[model samples]
Every structure is written in structure tokens, then in C-alpha cells.
Target chain A: MPTTLRDEAAIAGIGQTPYSKNSGVSELALACQAVRGAIADAGIEPREVDGLVTFLMDSSDEVEVARSVGLGDLSLLSRVAYGGGAAVPIVQQAAMAVATGVCRHVVVYRALNGRSGQRMGQGVSGDIITSDLIHWSWYMPFGMLTPASWVAMAATRYMHEYGDCADALAQVAVVTRNHAQNNPAAAFYGKPLSLEEYYNSRWICEPLRLFDCCQETDGGCALLITSPERARDLQQRPAVIRGVSQASFDGQEQMTSFYRPDMHRLPEMERAGETAYAQSGLGPADMDAAILYDAFTPEVLMQLEAFGFCGPGEGADFVRDGALAAGGRLPTNTHGGLLSEAYIHGVNGVAEAVRLIRGVSHNQPERCEHVLVSSGVGVPTGALILGRDNG
Target chain B: MLTPEQKQDLETQIRAFVGRPTGPPSVGRDLVNEPMIRQWCDAIGDANPVYLDPEAAARSVHGGIVAPPMMLQAWILEGWSMHRGHGEPRDEQQRLHKILTDAGYTGVLGTDTEQTFTRYLRPGDQVSAETVIADISEEKATGVGVGYFITTRTTFCDAKGIELGTMNFRVLKFIPKEAPQSAAANADAADAQPQKPTRIKPPLSHDNAWWWRAVAEGTLLPLQRCAQCQKLRHPPRPMCDDCGATQWDHIAASGRGALHSYTVIHHPRFPGYEFPILAALVDLPEGCRIVSNVVDCEPGALRIGMALQAFIHEDEDGFKLPLFRPAEPA
Candidate 1:
């Protein structure tokens, strides 16, 4: 019924600076690095650009990035909320531009010292003072201030439904580490992991070990989107955008939704996936590789079910069968991941999916064309399909 | 003044406010009290007659001087006043906390809250509180030592006990076998070093720096009042950073506050810096936003949201800083 966002456009180029702790670079500088790098990769002059997409959290301004990258007048530009979800949509937005002829080139970038810069786990310092925090204010007064603790609430419920969520959850961390070990660009690259190590990791919140959570890394990542014809003339191979969609669900409250009727079910993700799968005209059977957002391991299992990769409650069994491994039915987060790779938000996963479709990943699989990239789990999220230009 | 034991208990209870607890029967407030609502209004710099003039009340729609949804409610439990620690000073304060804990409320806690302003606040009205608790959870706490805590969602209402809104709060009552660590030793390691300070040019204020400087230190940056969020929030958010609720009212801070949380860093998240200085989250007397690392104080000595008056600390750069020190209690 609906056309995929993919057949509509392609990712002409991609770029990034090395992920790290102390980048010593201003948020502005890192943004420019990625923007220029993407432009050069796309083989398009900066001045030809007309659109931009980035995180609501990113500090860089559109005009500033345009100036830094030497881009000319812009006709289309926008910002996406709910961090990391913007990665693929940046390309989607660019493709839309070319489809409508409102803009020729679109670039999206995210640069931040997520760890060394603004520490999220630093506790509820600012939010608490407000009346808005009054809800969290109740919890804060008792000490439940961090995101990990809240997510753990959901994880606890999942574990209740399935006796062995820990093992399945750990699989995500292990596999991501497995990929990170092979990929030098990842923050945890060369580092390895074990199920024992995962379960034994320090506890941030109950039901969530330290390794179960996503790490904060300082880095910037960017991508370039344009029409396929224009992409062919660019400096790099183009990864055609196959399909894309974003979704937010009912009962959604920041990351802390403890009172939901059911913590185990992530309806928002299912809603997003339902729209995306139809748009892409591709189902789990068609996807050769996957790059699902893995901010938390439990999320991986929940996403598997939401995407219909497995039926409800069958996710653990599905993952246990090696369905989501490098040699398994669907290789996922092969670029490591936010869990193992440095978290450049969910955008890094987008880059990896593009690489998979382009057949250039460090953990490249055989004959991979249809790649799936997703945003964060639990929060408002999005996804996209990137395929080799089969046409 | 109360006895040493009462003082200690008061401090412990206060420390539990904010950040979820790992263990049991801990006490936190259920609703906004007249005093707390008053302070929040003043700190936020809302000068509306609804919060200041009681005589102007009785004529309004919601009837009495109903607090803005964002006002802080001083939580107390019933029957908790009988706790032996009351042998200490600050009798009224301890009594209130004790009542909150001992009332028929078992692990009754605050849950989620949403605020939309129909009218500004005014001082005094037939103020009373109604509370309801739900969503009970049994879990181990994070940070400090391990123990089980029960978290509940709370809704607060007006005098007729009519529901105004809700807040979810958590309480971890120690299950019989579980004993939480009573006193936590301050983090032992010496703070490593502060990062090389970013040479932000002097007078970083887009507004009046002089007024803010009157409150605190050099290089602390001027405490610019946000025209949005109707309170003295800092790190100067363009929108109400917490809820993204954008109705803003910028008022200069009264330069008074309390230290909410503090830690001396061993390593600066940035770079450079030779010694570890005190970095604390100051709960300003003005409502909204507890700022970070208002430097000065031996690392461990900073208590949770210590009463602080504003001061100006000088940094290596010529610019002034906004810092807070233990202020005379309001």
C-alpha cells in the first residue's frame, strides 16, 4: 500500500571522526569534520547542499554547519528528537528532498562528548528542581534517579515472563563485542566479552548488569543522501535507501514507564516496525543483515519479537538458535554496537547497515543487501532499509 | 534544637530525597505543604498575587490558593512522629517526617506528575492534602549498599482531598533479612584533578552579570534567570530543559540555596587541573534546577543539599564564578 522510503533515495556518502573519550574538540568542530567528510565522500561540493537533519540534543546549528562545510543557501532543513534515531532518517530526509526537487544534497551529523562532556548518569541534578520533575521528584526523593534503574524495571518484568532473559540479553552484548573485536573503529574494538563476564559485570540497576547498558562515548558520525544518479557521480558507492519510518507509542513517558500495563511489550516499536516493514515490502525473511539499536540487551530480544523475527515469547529461543549472529539467520550490530562499539547514538548503527549493504563492513557477510537499521528501544524510535541499487 | 540522634535522622532522611533508595521503610513526602509551595513560588520568582495575597483568594476559580503543579510539596507520613530520634532538635520538622512514615501508608510514595498552569500561585488558601498510592514494586536499590525497597506512585489532591495530580515516589522497606548499610563512608579516593578550564570569555551573560555576581563566585558564570520555566534554572536552557515545557519566566535568583549532592573528582571530565575541588549540586532556595560543582569545600564534607548562600569564586581566568556556601537556613 505504501512505497518504501528506500526506492525513493540513496545514501551517497558517509563520514566520521574516530570515537573517543577526550576528543578535545568542540561540538562544532566535530560536526564540521563529519559534514565535510560526508560531502567529500559523496563527491558533492558543499555548496550544492540544501538540507540537514541532526539530533535535538546536538549543539551545532544548521547555519553553523552550513558555513563550516561551506554550503550555500539551504532550502530544506530539520531536527529530529529522541537521540540516535536520526541516523538513517537523515538519508531519508535527503532522499525526500531529491524526490521533491527541493534540495539536492542533505547531510546529517551528531558530535558530542557524551561521556567526557555531558554525563547522563551524573544523577538528577537539573531536572529535579522543576515541577515537571515532580513525578520523578517522588522517585528522586527515594533515589531512583538514573535511566538504567528505570530500564531495569522493564527488564525485571521480561525476566519474569521468560526464566532466562539474562542469557538472551547477554547474547546481544557478546555478539556486539564479537564484532567490535574485529572492527578497529569501535571504542571496544579488540576487547572481547563472555557471558560470564556479562552477568558478572557491576550492577547499575537491578536486573541490568553494567554490560547490559549502553556506554557513553565521545564521537561524531555523519551521512550524505541524494538521488541515485547524483550518487553515481559521487566519490563513493551509494547505498540505496530502501524504506524508512519512525514511531512513538501510547503509554510512552521518557525512559521511565514503570506503571505500564505490561513492561515486556514494547508497542511503540511494533507500531514503527509494522509501518516500516510494509513500506520496505521486506519482512524478516528478506533482511540479510540487521543493525538494530542495542542500547540495552533486553531491548534486542524485545525488538526481535516486535519485528516478527520470532513470535512473542519466542525471541529468547530465536536468539539462542543463533538466528541473530554473524553466521546465523540475521547478522546484527556487526559494527559492534552501542553496547560494544562506541555509542555515537543510534546513528553508528545506520553507518554499519549502509556498510553492510555496500559490502564493506569489517564483519561483512556473504551476499548481504537488505540491511535493517533501527533507533533506540523503548523511546520513540525509527528504522530504515538500505539495499544495493539492484535496479 | 533537637537531640543529636534527631539531627542525624533528619540528615539521613533528607539524604534519601531524590535518587532511588536500595533498602526499606525510608520516608519521603506525599504532597505539597503550604511552606514548600511558598518557597517554590518565591524561588521561581513568580510575583503573581495568587501566591502572595491570601485575601485576594477565596474569589478564584479552583477556590483556594491552589499551588502551580510545579510547586515542591514537603512530604510527610502519618504516625512517623513517634520515631525515637525525635529526642533531637528541629522538633516540628522531625515530627512531620515521622507522621508521614507511620500513617496507614505503607511504602506510600510519589508517582509521576504533570503540570499545566491554569493560573499563577498566590499565598494562603484553605490548604490541605490528599494522597493515594499505587504501583507497588519490590526491588533492590542502586548506589550505596544493597537492600530491597518498595516504590509506589502517589497522587496529591486539595483539601476536600480532591485529586489535583500525581507523583510516583519509591520507598525501600528492608525485608527482614536485608539490612542496608547505616552510614556510608565518603568516597575515599582523593579527587584526581579538574580539567583545564575552558577559557570562556569574561561576562558570559547575555543578560545582567552584575546582579548574579552579587550572589556568587568568579568563573562560576553569572546565574542568569531564565525567562522560561518561571524559576531560577541554570546552565541556561533555551527551553525548560527538564520537561521541554516552554512557558518561561526569567527571574534573578535570590542567591540562596542548599547543597543537594556533592562529589570531589579524582579526574576532570575535561582535561588538566591539579587538585580536586568540591563539586556540589546546589538546591537553590529559588525553585527549579540544582547546578553542578559550585567549587570550594573539602570534597567529603559537602552534605546533601546543604543550606547555601551564593558567592563568587575566581578561577585562573579573569571571569567570575557563581558558587554557593552553607547559607543560614530559611
Candidate 2:
């Protein structure tokens, strides 16, 4: 039988450049800066790093990042696919490398000038010849162009089944922005969102208001991983990786997977959540807080159900009466999430999860023991269960 | 070249026909059958078992074989043998075409079409269609010529007199820009104007080129089937996910389906498209779903389980795609 990787590795440090719509610097520069910050935070020499992991969509090459960050000889240089769905898997890769002794200290990072360059919200450009081009051809001609439109196909169905959960969707945006008010690192830190304001925002796609969408941010976020044994000696208390998993279910498409029997659910998240909980010997009740991917507000609601925080179709009720706020039963995305924080393609969510486990987050909840962080929904996704070190 | 007065006179004559019936309702020569459905499936490469296998269809959502929704107009198309030769104008549409030809606008090109179906057509169902002039655009400059865009709406119905669906078809009637007389005089004129952006074309690949070719042919919507497991798949791929068989075939999809979910886009509008595009994920009766635009319906009127049908929209540049619209009650 295979052994569980639970508690084998730990996230020693978390770092990021400021979230901005225009990071005047190059993505490479932002990558190096975030990595440097993580290394310094880990209180380790730059040469101590032996592994590097990131998303395949990342423009920064492993060798270039290694050279820029002064990382020593890398034994495990890896990249995960599915752009926004890669955050937890990137950390999973580095954690596995550390747990297996393939590399002593591994760094995982994602860097992109998402808004200033190559905005993801823009429709598919016609010049590319990639594997995804074929599936896109089916809907692109019909003007199913941007990420918001792609997500809205499912969002519309979700509303139909649940009977217009716009208020619930608005609560996600409101609470996430509300948390950002205290976190200066958040792009919307000074700009709090009201429920009425969320309702009043213009539509990006029907049922998806402009506020429902995450910021098209330009920044980078990174984390350092090492075994629990090594993390004990690090400068800061390590956020132990209790469990982690990546899931891609059958009949999965890139992001336009609208053909499933139930277009409203996230099967990939369910599988990932199940596997992560089994590995950690925990359940939804064990999580003190969460950082469900908020690429869109609807996704957060779907994720709340998929992760078992609420019953199917009960995500709306679970979030009512300021449930996701600082003192609530399950404070989520307390660092503002992708909606108000940076959209580092979800690496920032992982970083925030680490902060929660460390009890040092700007919007830290009072009783956080286990933090559940998830990747982008509506695609092949991943999740993690990070806990405060008991020792 | 016509003077402003002549052009205004022609516009007045053409505009008078707007909202008037273009022709009497025409009945289809044959009832919907399995062979045509199979042919379309073979051409488009669709292989949904519910479309080809009666036994599977009995257990499937549709309950029986049906014609592809994209075949809505195909059922009512006048066959080659029935061509009304180059003689006198037959109906209001041909009469309008003749008047435009007489006015020196000799070029005619099919532009775009929007079609909607209320339900899928099972075998033995006969179809009938009635057409009316919808609208006409003011004279405008196009890449191929200077033309007026004429649009017509056609409503389809069953023999029972129940309303089935409708189509809004547009065409460009123009004078060729490259004609010898205009070439010398307007050589620099055409170059001085900025070219209009074209719709984003689909990327063709070896594995999926056949599917697009069939769509361009405007008769079928094919789904690929695994030779071994007999499972059907869409957006065409080489290998079968079920049996892992490299050998596969296709069947035509019955475009009849209900709306599963959809989105109305309002932001970051792309060039060459109308805003508030009603993009939908429609569940076909043959046990598959497609992503297509639902046309000629208000966003507010859209329902999750509303019935819909598909039609091939041949754009002005002759790009063909499958689009959908709601099934209207008679």
C-alpha cells in the first residue's frame, strides 16, 4: 500500500510583489523579486534551494529563475499545466520533492504581468496554434470569447438550479473586499465593496456583475518548501502541509466544460477536496478558514459546496449574515482573494493559506488551525490542507 | 451609375417590400428519414449512438432517431431537379433581385443566418416554411463590393400546424468593386479606407478538419464514434476515450435540444459580433451538448429547459457555422 504524504513537508515562507494592474517591471524581474523575498523569509542562503516548480503557463524559465535568484543546482525542476489550476499542484510538486529527499529545499513560484501584458480577460487571439485551439473553435465564432463568458455559461445554469443566487455571489465579493480593507498588500485595500455596490455594478456577462470578476492583476507570489524536520530549524514557524492533491476528472475540457450532466458543479474540486481530506485525516469541520479560488464569485459558491463546507445548493445560505467575515465560523479569503487581492493565477491564495496557518495574516481569524486553499474552479483543479505546526 | 434620385427611387421600391411575404409557404417534398440523418452524421462525423442506434435511442433522452437541428433549412431546400430556370422572376424575392440587377447591383452573396427550432424532428415528420422580407441596410462599402444588405425571416412549421422554428437570413446585393470600369477610377479609393475586421476563424487541424469541412458544407453536424465501444464524442479527436480504439466513425446529430445553461456577454465585445451575444450550452436529444449562439430571442425569454434547434449560418465571407434559436409555439 502507498503511504500518505501528509505532514511530510512544510511551507517555510511565503512572499510576493505588490498586486498591481501594471507592474512596470518585467515578469522575470517580478519572479526573481518574489523568490528572493521567499528565500530571505525562509532565513536560508540562496544556494540552499535545490528545486524549482511553477506553472507551464509561466513565462519565467526554471534555469533563468534559478540564475536570477541564485538558486543552486536544481534536482527537481518542474511545471504544472492548467494555468489558474496549477497553484496547489506547484506546491505539491515541491513538497513531494522535499519529502522524497530528491531536493532539500524547493521553491515554487508564479509570475505574470497579467493585466499590463497578455491579459487573460481578452478573447482568444487568432494567431496561436495550440491544443486548446480546437475546442475554442466551437464557441469562439459565436462570441464566447473571454474567461467571464466561459464561466458564465455554467454560472447561468447554477442560478437556474439554485434560483438566482446573485445576493450570495455578491456576499463573496463584499466579504473578500471587506477583508482587503486592512491588508495594504491587497489592490482593493482602501476600496471596500458594499452589497449594494456589488448589485449596482455593470454586468460583464449576465448573472456575473463586474465586481463578480477577479482583478486582472500584475504581480508574482512564491513559497519555499522543505521537510517538517528541516522547517523546524527555520526562522519562522512552518505551516505544515497536512495534505495536498491535484484532480482532473474524466471528460474535462480546459475551461469551457459545459457539457457535463451537471454544468453547475465542480467535480474536479470535489475529487481534490476528498483526496486532500482523506490524506490529512480531516474533514470540512476541521478547517478553521479557507481560501477558495475567487477568480469569479460564482466559483467561490460552487467551491463552498464541493469542499463540503455547505450542502449542495446551500452555499448561498452558508455565506449569509457575514459568515465569511473575520469572526465567522469559517473566515475565507481573509486576504481579499483574487477578487480584491492579486491574481497571481492563485499562487497568492496559497501564500495567504500559509499566512493563516502561521497566525500572521492581516485578516487573521481567531481560531485558525487548518486552512483549506483551493485553485481555480471550472477546470482541472487542486486543493491543499495546511495546518499550524503542533511541535 | 444611378443618380441620387434613381438610388433613392430604388431604395423606396425595395423598402416597400419590407414586412411583406416574400413567397407562399413551401412544403418539403419528403418526410424526415434516417438516411439523411445518417448522411449528415457521416459528412459531419457525429456518432452519438442515440442518433444512429434505435436500441440506444430507446434508452436515450430523445427516445428515437431524429434529424439534426442544423438540417432545419435543409428539409425545406428546393432540390436541384426543381430549379426554376433563368426565366421570369418567380416571387417577391426574385422580383427584388431582378430590380437590384437592373439597377447595376449585379453581385449577390449570402451573408449570415440565424435559425431557431422549437423541437427535434423524428422520422416521418414533414416540414413547411414561410418567408418574409425582414430588413434592408443602407448602401455601404464592403471588401468585395459596394452593396445593400437584405435580410429575410422564415418561419418553419410541422404538418400538424404547430410552429416549429424560424430563421433570419441576410444577403448582400452589390456591384463588384473590381469591375473594369470601377478599377481604374477607384483604385486608390478602396486602398485609402481602413479594412474592416473579419470574424475570428476557427483553427483547423488534422484531427478536426473534417468536422469544420462538414459544417462549411451546411448540411450536417457530425459526432465521432468509437468503432469498438461505440461511444460518441464531439469537437472531434483521433482516439476514443472509452475503448481507446484508434478506429472510429461518425453520425449526424439531431440538433434538437433543450437549453442547459447560457451566458449573455456584455463586456469586452469582440469585433464583427453583436453585443449581448446569447451563448448557450444546449443538450441535444442524442445525448450530447454543444456550445452555440442562441439567436433571435431576448435574453429575458431564455429558460434552462427551453427547446431549441440548430441551423447553419453562412456569413458574408462564406464562413459557415452552426447557431441556434428558440422553438416558438404556433
For model 1, how does the per-residue alpha-carbon lDDT over B237-305 read when each residue is reduced to its tens digit? 445544566444444566677654343433222222333434444555554444434444554455554
Per-chain TM-score of chain A in candidate 1 equals 0.94
Estimate every model's Cα lDDT from 0 to 1.
0.63, 0.86
For DockQ, the strongest prediction is 2
Residue range B161-192, candidate 2, lDDT tens digits: 89889999998878765453444223222122
Model 1 regions more than 4 Å off: A1-6, A127-135, B1-330
Query: What's the TM-score, to 2 decimals, of chain B in model 1?
Result: 0.30
**True lDDT of residue B243, candidate 2:** 76
lDDT of 1 at B62: 48
| Model 1 TM-score, all chains together | 0.55
Off by over 4 Å in 2: B1-190
